[model samples]
Target: MVYLDNNATTRLDDAVLQAMLPFLKDEYGNASSTQHRMGRKANEAIQKARIQIAQSLSASDPSEIFFTSGATEAINWALKGVAERYTSLGNHIITSQTEHPAVLQTCAQLQKRGFEITYLPVGRDGLINLEDLKSSIAEKTILVCLMAANNETGVINPIADVANICQERNVLFLCDATQYIGKTDTVNLQNIPIDLLCVSAHKFHGPKGIGALYIRRKRQPIQLETMIAGGQQEKGFRGGTYSVHNIVGMGEAIAHSAETDWRSIANKRDYLEQELAEKLKHVAINGEQHDRLCNTSSITIKHVLSSELMSQIPDIAISSGSACATGTRDPSHVLLAMGLSPDDAKCTIRISLSKYTTDGEIEQTIEAIVAAVHKIRSNSPTWMLFEKGLLD
Candidate 1:
C-alpha cells in the first residue's frame, strides 16, 4: 500500500530496529540497577540515547531531557507538574483552542479543579493571533501551552514568537513539538525559548511508546512536582523503569533524521500536491499554506467524504484527521478552531509523507486519489449540483 499517513505514525526505520535488537535481547537489564555489568551497560546506553536526543534538539544539557511513553504523557507531565509546582504563583493558564486532546483534556481537568484556562481562538488559516495572546495574559497567568505543529493540518504555529512573549512575561511556555521534529529543521530550542517541549519518536520513523520532554535549566531550575512518584526514576520526576530498546531506537531515528536533508522530502510532497490539485477542480488547501510542515498537506474536497473516498483507493492509505480519532464522526477540533464548518472539516483529508517515500509512490497516490474522488463524486448529489451549473 502507498502509505500517506506519516502524520499519524511512521514505519520504524531499519537502522532504528537494528539498534533496538541488542537492547531487547542480551542487553536487557534495568537501567535503574547499578550493581552488575549488565545493569551498567543498560545505564550507559540509556544515557547515550538521552544525550543523542538532547543534541538533536540543540539542548545544552542532557540531564534536562526526561524520557516518557510519548508526547501525550510528556504534555501531561508538563501541564500537571508545572501547575502543581507553581500553585502558589497563580491558578490561570493560557492555550489555543486547536491544541491536541492531551493538552485540551488536561486543561479541562484543571478547569474542573478551579484553575482558570483561557483558550485563544485561531483564524481561518489556523494561526493564533499574538494580540489575542497578549490580551489573554494576566497577573494570574502562570503557564501557556501551545503546539509547535498541528497534527491534522501540519500548520506550524509561530512558537518562537509565542515563547518570546511568554518569556518576557515570566510565564512558563510548554510546547507540543511532536509533529514538527523530524519533518523539519526548526528544532533549535534556543530560538524558541521554550521552558518545556514534547516530542514523540513514533512520528519520525522510531518505535512507539518512546518520547522525551526537554525542561530548560536556569538559575530558578524549573522544578516540577512528580506525578508518577515511585522508584525515583527519571530524576524523581517520572517513576518507572525505562524502556531501553524503545529509547535506543528513538535515539537512532533522531540521529539519522538530523543528518538527512529534509528539503528533498518537502519537494516530493509538494510535487504530489501540485500534480493532483491541477486535476481536481473542487479542491481547497486547508490551513495556512506557507506556515506548515513540508511533508504534510491537508486538503478539502467539496461535497466529498474524505475517509469514504480514500477507502476506495485500496493501494493508498490516507486519513481524515488524527489517527487517534479517525473512526469518529465528530469533526476535527483543530479544523473547527480554524473556523471551518463541520462539513468542511469532515471532507478534509490529510496526506503526510516521509523521506523514505519515493517519487513513484507519490505518483501512484495521486492516481489513486483521483480515482477515489471520481468514484465518490459520481454518486454524490452535492457534486451533481456543481456539474449541473447550479453551484457557482
Candidate 2:
C-alpha cells in the first residue's frame, strides 16, 4: 500500500529497530534500580538516549528532557503541570483554536478548575494572528500554549515570534512541536526562547508510545508540579519505569532524521500536489499561501467527500484528518477553525509524506486520487450543476 499519512505515524526505521533489539532481548532491567550491573547498564542506556534527544533539539542540558508515552501525555504534563504550579501567579492560559485536542482538551479541563483560557482564532491559512495573541495576554495570563506546526494542514506557526512575545510578557511559552521536530530544523530551538516543547517519536520514523518534552533549564527554570508521583525518573517530574527499548529506538530514529534529505522529500510532496491540481478541477489546496511543512499537503476536492474518495482508493493509505480524531464524525476542528465550511472540511484529505516516500509512490497516489475524485464527483448532481455554471 502507498502510505501518505506520515503525520499520523511513520514506518519505523531499520536502524531504530536494530538499536531496540538488544534492550528488548538481553538488557531488560529496571532503569530505576542502581544496585546491580544489569540495572546500571539499563540506566546508562537511558541516559545515553536522553543525551541523544537533547543534542538533537540543541538542548544545552540533558536533564531538561522528560520522556512520556507520547505527545499527548507530554502536552498534558506541560499544560496541567504549569497551571497547577503557577496558579498563585496567574490563572489564565492562551492558545490557538487549531491546536491538537491534547492541548485543547487540557485547556478545557483547566477551564473547569476556574482557570481562564483564551483560544485565539486562526485565519483561512490555519495561522494565528500574533497581534491577537499579544492583546489577549492579560496580567492574569501565565502560559501561552501554541503548536509549532499543524498536524492536519502542516502550516508552520510563527513560533519564534510567539516565544518572543511570551518572553517579553514574562508568561511561560509551551510549544507543541510534535509535527515540527524531525521534519524541520528544530536544532535552532536553543535561540528561540521557548520554555517548554513537546515532540513524539512516532511522527519521525520512531516507535510509538515514546516521546519527549524539552524544558529549558537556563531560562529561570519554571517549576512544574509532578504529574505522576512515585519514582524519581525524569527528575521526579514523571514517575514510571523507562521503556528502554523504545527510548533507544527514539534516539536512533532522531539520529537518522538528522542525516535525511528533507529537500527531496519536499519536492516529492510538491509533485504530488501539482499532479493532483493539474488533473482535477475545483481542487483547493488548504493553507497554500502559508509556510507549511515539507511533507504535508491538505487538499479539498469540491463536492467530493474525503471518506468516499478514500473508499474508492483503498490501496492508498491516507487520512481524512488526524489519526487522533479518526473515529469522531464531526468535521475536522482544524479545518473548521481555518474558516472551512463543514462540507469543505468533510471533503478535505491530508496527504503527508516521509523520507521513505518515493517518486513512484507519489505518482501512484496522484493517479489514485485523481481517479477516485473523478469517480465520486461524476455521481454528484452538485458537481454537475457547478460544472455547467448553474451552481456556485
Candidate 3:
C-alpha cells in the first residue's frame, strides 16, 4: 500500500527501534529507582533522552522538558495546569478555531470552570489574523494558545508574531508544535517568546505513546499546578513511571531526523500537487496561498465525496481528516473554520508525505487519486449538472 498519511503517524525508524529494543528487554528498570545499578542505569538513560530532546529543540536546559503520554496529554496538562495556577491573574484565554481537539476540548472544560475562551477565526487559507488576536486580548487574558502548523491543512502559523504579541501583553504563549517539530527547525526557540510547547514522538517517526512538553524556565518560570501527583518524575510536574523504551526511541528518532533531506520530500510533495492539478479539473488546493508544511497537501475535488474517493482507492492509505477524529462522520472542523462549506469540507482529503516516501510511491498515489476521483465524479449528480451547464 502507498502510505500517504504521515501527518497522522509515521513509521518507526530502524535506528529508533534499535535504540528502544534494549530498554524494552534486558535493560528494563524503573526510572524512579535510584538505589541499585539497574535503576541508576534507567534513570541515566531517561536523563540522556531528555537532554537529546532538549538539544534537538535548542532548549536552554533539560530540566525544562517533561515527558508525557503524547501530545494530547501534554496539551491537556498545559492548558488545565496553567488555567488552575493562573486563575487569580486572569480567567480568560485566547486560541484559534483551527486548533486540535486537545486544545479545543481543554478550552471547553475550562469554560465550565468559568474561564472565558476566545476562539479567533481563520481565513480561507487556514491562517489566523494577528489583528483579531491582538484585539481579543483583554486585561483578563492570561494565555494565548496556538499551533505552529495545522495538522489537516499543514498551514504554518505566524507563531513568532503571536509570541511577540503575547510577550508585549505579558501573557503566556503555548504552542502546539506536534506537526512542526521534526519537519522544521524549532531548535532556536529561545529567541521566540513562547513559554510552553508540545511535541509528539509518533509524528516524527518515533514510537507512539511518548511525547514531551517544553516549559521555558525564564523570568517567572511559567508556574503550573501538577496534573498527576505521586512520584517526582518530570520535576514533580507529571507523576508516572517513565516509558524508557519510548523515550529512547523518541531521542533516536529526533536525532535521525537531522540527517533527512527535507528538500527532496518537498519536491515530492510539489510534484504530487502538480500531477493532481494536471489530472483533475476544478480541484481546489486548500491553503495554497499560505506557507504550509513541505510534506502536506490538502485537496478538495469539486464534485466528489472524500469518503467515496478514498473507498475507490483502498490501496492508497490516505485520510479524509485527522486520525484522531476517524470514527466521526462530521465535516472537518479545520476546513469549516477556513470558510469551506460543509459539502466542500466533506470533499476534502489530506495527503501527507514522509522522508521515506519515494518518487515511485508518489506516482502511484497520484494515479490512484486521479482514477478514484474520476470514478466518483462520473457518478456524482453535481458533476453531471455542471457538465450540462445547468449548475453554477
Candidate 4:
C-alpha cells in the first residue's frame, strides 16, 4: 500500500524499535527508585532520553522537558495550568480557530469556568493574520495559544512574530508543535520565545503513547500550577510511572530525524502534485500561497468528492483532510476556518509523506489519483457541463 497519511501518524522506525528492545525485555525497573542497581540504570536511561529530547528542540536545560501521554494531554495541562495560575491577573485567552480539537475543546471547557476565549480567524491560505493577533491582546488577556504548523494543511505559522508580540505584552505563549517538532527547525527555543510547547512522539516516527511538554524556566520563568498532582515524579511536573522503553524509542526517533533526506521527499511530493495536476483539470492546492511542510500536499479536485475518489482507489492510503474525517459529510473545521466552502472542503485530500515514502510510490499514487479523479468527475454534473464547454 502507498502510505501518505503521515500527518496522522508515522510508521515507527526499525532503529528506534531496536534501541528499545533491551528496556522492554530485561531492564524492567522503576525510574522513581534509584537506590538499587536496576532502578538506578532505569533512572539514568530516562534522564538521558530527557536530555536527548531537550536537545532535539534546542532547549537550554533538560529540566524544561517532561513526559505526557501525548500532545493532547500536554495541551490540556498547559491550558488548564496557565488559566488557573494566572486567574488573578486575567481570565482571557487567545487562540486561532484552526487549532487542533485538543486545544479547541479545552478552550470550550475553560469557557464553562467563565474564562473568556478569543478564536482568531485564518485566511484562505490557512494563516492567522499577525495584525489580528496584535489587536486581540488586551489587558485581560493572560495567554496566547497557537500551533507551529497546521496538521491538515501543513502551513507554517509565524512563530517568531507571535513570540515577539506575546513577549512585549507580557503574556505567556503556548505552542502546539505536535506536527512540526521533529520534522523542521522552526521549533528552536534559543530563538523563539515560546513559553510552553506540546509534542507527540508518534507524529515523528516514534512510539505511540509517549510525548513531552517544554516549560520555559529561564530568562522569565513560567510558573504553571500543577494539573497532574501526585508524587514528585517529573520533578513535580507530572505524576506517573515512566514508560522506559517508549521514552528510549522517542529519543532515538527524534535524534535520528537529522539523518532523513527530507529534501528528496519534498521533491517527490512536488513531482506527484505536478504530474497529477497536469493529468487532471480544475485541481487546486490548499496553502499554495504560503510556505508549507516539505512533505505535505492538500489537493482539491473541483466537482469531485474526496470520499468518492478514495473509495475508487482503495490501494492508496490518504486522508480527506484531518485523519480520515472527509469520509463523512461533515467538513474539516480547519478547512472551514480557512474559508473553504463545504463542497470544496469535502473535495480536499491531504497527502503527507515521510522518510520511508519512495519515489516510485509517489509516482504510482499520482497515476492512481489522476485516474480516480477523472472517474469520479465523469459522474459529476458540473464536470459534464465543463466537458460540454458550457461552464468555465
lDDT measured at residue 172 in model 4 versus the true structure, 0 to 100? 92
Give per-residue CA lDDT, model 3, range 132-198, as digits (tens).
Answer: 9999999999999999999999899989999999999899999999999888665467778789999
The lDDT of model 3 is: 0.90
Query: Please, what are the lDDT tens digits per residue for candidate 1 over residues 233-351?
Result: 88887888889999999888988887656888779877887777798877888774557888898888887887687768877888888887766789999888887889878889999
TM-score of each: 0.97, 0.98, 0.98, 0.96
Model 1's number of clashes is 0
Cα RMSD for candidates in order: 1.4, 1.1, 1.0, 1.6
lDDT of 2 at 38: 89
Q: Clash number for every model?
A: 0, 0, 1, 0
Clashing pairs in 4: none
Per-residue alpha-carbon lDDT of candidate 4 for residues 1-392, written as tens digits (9 for 90 to 100): 99999999999999999988888979999888888988888888888889988888889899889898889999999999999888998999999999988999999999999999999999998998999999999999999999999999889999999999999999999999998876665378989888999998899899999999999886656768775778788877687788999998888888888787777887888898888778888788889799888888999888788888989889999988776343456888998988888888888999999999988898889889888887777778988997889975
Runs of candidate 4 with Cα error greater than 4 angstroms are 324-328, 386-392
Candidate 2 Cα misplacement greater than 4 A, ranges: none
**lDDT measured at residue 369 in model 3 versus the true structure, 0 to 100:** 88
In terms of lDDT, the poorest run of 10 residues in model 1 is 281-290
User: Roughly what TM-score does model 2 have, to 2 decimal places?
Assistant: 0.98
